[model samples]
Structure formats: structure tokens, C-alpha cells
Target chain A: MNAVSRALTDGWVITKRNLIKIKRVPEVLIFVLISPIMFVLLFAFVFGGAINPGDGVSYKEFLIGGIFAQTVVFGATFTGAGLAEDMQKGIIDRFRSLPMSPAAVLVGRTTSDVVYNVLSLIIMALTGLLVGWRIRDGALDALAGFGLLLLFAYAISWVMAWVGLLVPSVEVINNASFIVIMPLTFVSNAFVPIQSFDGVLRTIVEWNPVSALTQAARDLFGNLPPGETVSDAWSLQHPALYTLLWVVGILLVFVPLSVRQYRLASSK
Target chain B: MAVAGNDGDEGVDELTEMISATGLVKRYKNVEALRGLDLSVPEGKVLALLGPNGAGKTTAVRILATLIKPDEGTAVVAGRDVLNDAEGVRRSIGLSGQYAAVDEHLTGFENLEMVGRLYGLGGVASKARARELLERFDLSDAGDRPSKTYSGGMRRRLDLAGALVAAPPVLILDEPTTGLDPRSRQQMWEVIRELVGAGSTLLLTTQYLEEADKLADDIVVIDHGRQIARGTADELKSQTGGERIEVVLVDDGDRDAAVAVLGQVATGEVQSGDSERALTAAVTGGADSLSQVLAGFAAGGIAVLDIGLRRPTLDDVFLSLTGHATESDTDSDAGSAGGEGA
Candidate 1:
């Protein structure tokens, strides 16, 4: 095969290797699957009675989109952590020493991590349904919303992939991703409505990509209450388009950056 | 030592020099892992890089393996420039690093198959190659088990097998038997010997003097990121000098008399091992020195528990050159920084 074709083919092999880790190490999958369920239960029940999205909307319905946003965003950490852990192992040196494409490792890692998001999405959706979350929008639109979430998560995975290579340790990647993600998810419309925030925080939330993703999910799922309009900011006005821009922007910036970093990354 | 031909003979067509590097310098922060080191390995010959902890053996291997680039200088492996044609170099070399680089989660077969695939062997061929290697490494039964479950030696064999997946012309092994048991180490040596016997050029790094003595056609002694000496094993031994007469006394009291007698035949400094109740001195004139030492001891009435004339080992060579024993510091000074992390 040609170089590019070989890279993709090699990437597929690595992706399969990663997926096998998920299978062999079921605890990883269990923990990943449980967090989304726990998020659905915790936010829908613990914070459900206290937080209000608006009139005509149960907190459960409002929380589903936010939960999906948060879960998928959290899922991106797997990519970074996986890369960092692989970095710590001798396996990476083996990979580097091989004649395979350098980009294949990162491409495979980010690709396989999409499975984590998909699995958690399935579990979260089931849990969301049990908790009385409903999708009023048509099935195709809802499918589109899920697709956007996966796409957004995949892009975010590249960002984490870059961080994974930049950092020194796998444990550090976890804490590092937490530092960046915790604020991005919580400060947006993930667990609370944008209206709940005040002044600068509200403006920040209105433009936050997490908020755009959550807002788009809510719009597609028809979870937004009638008459309760989103923020007037252009980002919130076209949440899907804004979210897509962030996805594209993140991929464009991180893909090559991480690949370059991968080339430089040696097994310590 | 077979130094690189300095004639700049571009058309020499010497396939013998499968790997060569000049003035390789790698710095990790303030530590210079490799400083102006040069190396070359003839085709189908084994070159052992012998050194202690922080001696830059691994650093040199990493550069040649194309796992990391040096800060200054250049390397070519299998006729490909390490910097400009790293992929080409990689395609021609099989590298087994200090730690076994096999995946723990994957079965032995799976790990080798993955390596084969990455080396660009197609799916079916990768599997066949993996099975073939499994059989060759004596791991056919354990091939289905995850590498994490294998014994350390088994894991190491699996790792070496992974490196051989593509049967690259050049092979680099960095301390391949560092943690192995004696039997396993011997087994690994046998495997390595077979590879060399098959006419694959090999460059291996090791702290064990015996390992280098047994496996290497030529030895490079590196310390503190620099090449101190390079030669064949016999050449290195002879360069260190002639055999030494070691006299051990039954009691510590006789040590003084034994030391005095040994001094007569001693050609170099008469060194005493205080706790071992022994005095050793480098002696020239071989058998003549031995007879003189024995006759002198008899005249002095020094009780001799043991006495022998021993040839210089690589250990002696290491000590004579580095002013230290040939033992693993368990860490190399230059090993701490600058290599890329995966």
C-alpha cells in the first residue's frame, strides 16, 4: 500500500488494538459506562428539584441534553489518558520503532475513543428515558444531534491527544484534562441553565462551545420549553453551526499539532 | 578497531557497514547523554556497546533505532540517513529496547501480529508470521495468553520476537537481558547467536561484561556519553594488560607476608582486598612471574590458601579504563533525559 493508505491501514490496526483493551479490561468500560448513568441519575434527581431551565420544561428533560454534553466531553479525556498511558509503556516504543506511519498512533487512539462516547451515550440514553426524559423532535433530527455530539467529542479527543503528548505522565493527563474540562462543562449550560449565571459568566456561557453543544442537543431533542428562548448571542442563535465551527476549529488546530508531537514523543 | 574509511570513498560499495554514526551529541537539559560519539557495525557482525549506568549505550541505540534524533551529528542505518530517511532506516532495523515493548493487554500472538501489520505485512501474512515467530521463540503454547501473564523471560522472548517480525537486516537490542534470570539470559544469548549466525547485523547494549565478551565481535566501551575505547574482545583484554597473580592467605595475619611476597613479582601496584584476605598484583612474564611469586612465598613462609595467574577479563578492562568496576549502576547518567517519550 501507499504511504497514506498504509497510515490509514495501520491506524485501523491500532484502533482494533485499543478496542481490544476495552474488551480485555472491562473495568475501564464499566467505569466509563457508569459515570454517564451516574450523571443522569445525579443531575436529574439531586439537582433536578433545585434547578429550573424555564416553564413548561421538567428539569429531567432539560438535564438530558446537558448530561449528554457533559458525558461526551468527559469521554474525550479517555483519548488523552490512553495516549499518555501508552506513552508510559514500552508498547509505544515498539510502535515508534516500526516502519508504520507516525500519525497512525494518534489517529487510531482518537478513533477508538469514539467507541467510549458511543457506549456511554447508549447507557445514558436508557437512563435518561427511565428518568422521564423525552425526545419530542423527529428521530432523524435526534440522530443528527447524537452525531454532532460524537463529532464534537472526536474533535475534543484530538485536543486531549495533544495534551497527552505534551504532558509527562498519564496520571497528570487525567488531572490536566479535569482542570480544563471541569470549567468548560460546569460553567456552561451543562448542569445549569445559562440564565442562572450572571454578568460575565452568562456571556461566557452563551458563547461556550459546551453550551452551544448542549443548546443544539436540546433544540434537536425538543427539550427546550416553548416560549423559553435561548440567549440572543449569535452562537446560541445558531447552536449547531457554532458547535460545528468549534469542532472544525479544534480538529484543524490539534490534528497536525498532536501528530507533530507524536513524532517527537519517545518512550522515556 | 575498524574505523570508518576516511577516504570519503562514496563508491566503496561496502555493504559491511550496515550502521554508522559520527559525532552524535544528545543533550537532555544540562546532561549530555552522548558527546561526540562515533560508531560503526559491519554487516553480519555483532557489535556490543558495553558501559555502566549513564554511559550512553541506550542513547546511542535510540539514535540508531530512529526512536530519537540527536541534538547534533548524523547516523545512518542500513544505508538510510537516520534524520532524513528515518522511516527507511526503521524499515530496515528491528529494535528491542531496555524494557520489553510488548502490549500487556494483547496476547503474544496478537502483539507480534500487530507489529507485523504495522511493519506493513498484510493481514493474512501478519498472522502467519506471528505464528512462525511464536514457534521460533518457543512460545507457541503461550501465544494465546496475554503478554501480561507471561513470565519475565517469556515476555522478553515475545518482545524479541516482535522485533523480528519483519526480519529487518539490522537489529538493535538495548539491554535485552537486563532483568532476566541466568537460564533465561543464556537462552536469550542462544537466540541472539542464532540471529547473528543467520547473517543479521546486530548491535546490542549491555552492562554485563560477560555478555559483551560472549556475543560481540567488536566492543565499544562508553562512559559519560563518550567513547573511551573500541576493539575486539581480545584486543580490549590485551590492551588492559597481562594476567595478574592473586594470592589469598588462610589468616589475615599472613596477608602482610603474602602482600610482601607478591610485591616481588608484581609488575604494577600490589592491591590488597582487605576483607577477602587477598593481595592481587598485575604480573608480567606470565609463567616466570608465577614461579617467582611461588618461590618468594615459600621463602617468606607465607601460608597460601589459593594462588593463580588470571587473564584480564572485560571487568579488568572496564576498571583499568574507567577507574570503576564493571557493575550496573542500575541507571545511566546520560539516560535521564532528552529521548522522545511515546
Candidate 2:
């Protein structure tokens, strides 16, 4: 009836439809399970020892924060791919003719991916715990850490979905999302400390949302603190707060912008 | 009396137009698709948009369905401004497309139910709607089967059923029966006729002149995103000026001599078919011209296999209007073949 209710109903229907698709295909859940889980295991074995603790916590625990940021951002790149596929398949055009709010389709799709990424994070986090990583903070703090990661995932995914809407073809999706996502992930302190870099790289990492999220999660993990980390925005002064600020800030800006683009393009 | 194709001017009365668009322009990249197109559809009737490839018939339908917006036009569906009231426009219309829009992963039943749910029907009400559409479309038995396995006609039927799930008052079809077999196309025609009989307004775009002749209450012919002519089927055919005299030649070479001889009396347009073996000319004065036409050919020693007087078809109207055929409106072999995997 109204915008909000219509958007909610449309989003729910799309989410349900996607779920039906997943039920029929079944390969998609693997990304929300095995794919991210495998990446976590890779980081745990390959880069765990390199993540030295600045405040005397174990490197594996320190890696958790970086892993959290890495997993969600990696998960986000698929949003664009899914969108590109839907566009190529003409689903977007079909949606344009529907009576519901056009914006709701994008919101529902991005939210659905956020749900998958959150599930993946849980699996990855549990895998981390099984291998001797522990969060010194209480369960509430761990949840807050996850909440920040999910929010960050949603904001980034929204941008990528817009990219999906703008890209010319589905063939370009993987390369495009990866090209956009990888540099942002690597530039952040996903695998190492920004302090370890002395110049331009350090400056880039410091302002990076990926770095902000990792720093926020590390603070929430009570794992370790970099001398430069703050605890204000997400967990205060830590990049998590900055990341949270950026997450909400990005969602606020990009979600509406993405909806506008999707609606305009889809209208054709 | 249906006057279904009104082409904007809303104060003109709702009963005058089932669908209307003015200055409907859609541009993709540097190319303009529907450039300054104006169209209309009156209530409880059918109007067909006829155009060759890239002429913007599909674009107009897309705009009218509210699936896309015109860059510089205003469209109102079922009496609501398309740009300012898109949702209301969407609520008042149904759309069936050239390609079946049903989800492949879902059963026929599920596709209709999903559309119902998206339209805000509760579960029970939605399922009830789905059942009704499925049965009405003669898809009840296989409604529970996945759509991917359905035949082309079956999938298309499912798609049309899904569009009607909400029972929208206005229906827009974009070359919906393009590749359907005769039976399937006829079935679709019956369904469309039934919709009009029930007082639903309809607008359709088609490459098939015969389909338009058989179905449309009125016809609108467009060329290069502009209206060339609009009239009833018989009205258009009658106004085509001269009766067409077609001569099927024994060889393509005879075409030149045939043209040369018939050139004397061909006071109207002359077009050679693609094979160059069949030469057709519109000659005036009916019986007099027909006689002269035969004498000229006989004197030229051209063997005339067959001769007949025939009313101008929509083909003649299109050829006269656009100087080409409408069936080439899209890329060749695009959704055009297959015995229809039924």
C-alpha cells in the first residue's frame, strides 16, 4: 500500500524467490558455506604466523579480525555478479513491470546476500575457534563484532550491486567485482598491520574501511590493539567505529543511489 | 465503436483509450529507439503496433507497460500518468512478452503463485488465483511441473497466466505470439478475444500482419519510430489505393520483362519479392488495368502462370508505409524457430 510496506513485501517475495532458486540449484549455498570456510582455513594456515600480535595476543586471534573483514568483502563481490546475471537473464525487466517499489528488489537482493555472508562468517568464525583462536571479549562483544561486519558487508554489496547494474555484460562480472574488491581488501590491513607500512600504503590502509572493520573487530575480540587504533565509531576510536560509521554512512548514501540507478535502468 | 487506440489526449475520455502514449522516446546509447512516438489504445478492444526491425513497436509497448520510461513523452495507462503514477499504471495493466517470463526453476503453478504474491495476494488468495489462471490457460495438469520442461507454447501460456494473476484491467502484449505455431497462435488469439469480450482493454505489437488482421480492432503502422498510418484492418486494406496483381514468373529473368511490360499500367507501387521470381504491382482502374496488364505481358512474350485480384493485406499496408516487411522487426532466428518443445 505504502512505500515502506510495499518495499518490505517486494523484498520478502524476492528473497523467497531466490531461496526457491537456491533450493532448485543447490550450488549457491556452497558459497555461503564451503567457499568462505575454505578461504578462512587458507588464511589460518598460510598467513596466521605472519600476523604478529602488537599487544601480546596470539596471531591466530589477531587474524580473526582481518579474516572477518576479508570474508565479508570477498562475499560482497558476488552481489554484482548475481545482479549482472539477473540483468542478462531479463529478470530485472520483469521486475520493472511489477507493482511493488522498484527499490525493494535491490534491497531484498543485497539483504539476502548479507544473510548469506553472515552465515559464512559464522562458519568461518567457528572454524577459527576450533583451531585455537579465542575472543577475550564477552559473547555480546562478539555479536557486536559480527553486527559491524554484516553492516559493512551490506554497504559494500550495495555499491557492487550498482556496479552490476552499470556493467555492460555478465561476462565481465567476476573480473570486475574481483578487480574492484581485491585492491580494497589488500589495501586494508586484512593480512598485516598498517604500521608495518611506512608511507603511502600506510596512509591508504589507515583510511580504508577494510582496515577500519578489522581494527574494530580486533578491539571487540579484545584480541589486541594497534597503537594507532581508536574506540569511538564502532568500538570507539578503532577502525571498527570508522568502519561502522562508513557502513551506515555508505548504506545511507549508496542504497538510495543504487535503487535510483536500478530503477532508471530497469525501467527500459 | 471500440476506438481502443486513442494515442494520448487523456481528456478525450477513458472509454476512448485503453492505453495512450505521447512523445514516447526511448534511447539506448547513441541510437534513438522510440523517437517521438505517439500511440493509443481504446477500451475493450485490440490495437496492434506494426513496424519493421528497429522501428520502435516493441519500445512503445515497453513504455506503455511501465516496464520502461520515455525520455521525452508522457504515457497514461488506464487513465494514470505513466511517469508520475507508475505504480498505478502498473496496477492497471497486464503484460505478456515475446519471450516467456516464467521462472524456469519454478513449476507453472509456482510461477503464477509467485507473481500473485508479488502483487500482494495472501497465500490462500494467491494460490486460488494461480489455480484459476492455470486452468483457464489449460495448464492444470502440468502446472506442478517445472517450467523448464514445458513446451514453448506451454511456457508462454504460463507466462500470460502469470501476468493475469492480478487481473489487471489493461493488457499489453509485445509480439507475444512471434514464434508460436498456428494452433498456439490461434489459442492465444482466442484468449485475447476472450479478454476483450470480458471488457479488458488490450494493446499488442506484432510482426505478423495476418495476426493483426485476425485480432486487432484497429491497427497502427509505424516506421522508424513514427506513426505512418492508423486504421481498422479492412479500412487500411481498402485505402491501399489499387488492387494488387501478382505474377509468379517462370524464372527471375522474366521478372525484368514482366516489370517492363506491367510498368505501362502500374500506376501504383511495384515491388519484387526477395526471390526476384514473383513480381507484384499495384495497378489502378481495377478491371481495365488488369486487362491491359495481361495484354502488355502477352505482347512481350512473357509467360504469365497465374493472375488474380486480391485485397491489400497488412503486408501491402506495411510495404506501402515503410517500404519493407514487418516480420524482419528483430534479429533473424532470434526466438524464431523450433517446433516448440511442447
Winning model by lDDT: 1
DockQ of each: 0.63, 0.28
| Candidate 1 deviant stretches above 4 angstroms | A1-3, B1-15, B241-245, B251-277, B281-315, B324-335, B340-342
How well is each residue in B1-342 modelled by candidate 2, as lDDT tens digits? Answer: 224346555444446665777787766654566668777776688888875556677677777776666789888788888888888888888888777777788888888887888888878999999999889999999999888899888988888887788899888887778888989888988988887788888888887667788888888887767888888876777666547677787766677778887777776557775566777777756678788878887887777667766656656777776676555434322321110011
TM-score of 2: 0.81
Residue range A1-268, candidate 1, lDDT tens digits? 6767877899999999999898899998999999889889988889899988899999999999999998899898889888888888767788898888888998899889988899999999999999999989899999999999999999999999999888848788889888999999999998887888899989999999999999999999999988767688999989999999999999889998998999888768
Stretches > 4 Å off in candidate 2: A49-51, A54-56, A225-236, B1-15, B23-30, B239-315, B324-342
Indicate the residue-level lDDT of A247 in model 2.
Answer: 78
In angstroms and one decimal each, the interface RMSD of every candidate reads: 2.3, 6.4
Q: How does each model score on lDDT? A: 0.87, 0.75
Worst 10 residues of 2 chain A by lDDT: A228-237
Taking all chains together, each candidate's TM-score versus the true structure is: 0.90, 0.81
Model 2: how far is B320 from its true place, Å?
Answer: 2.7
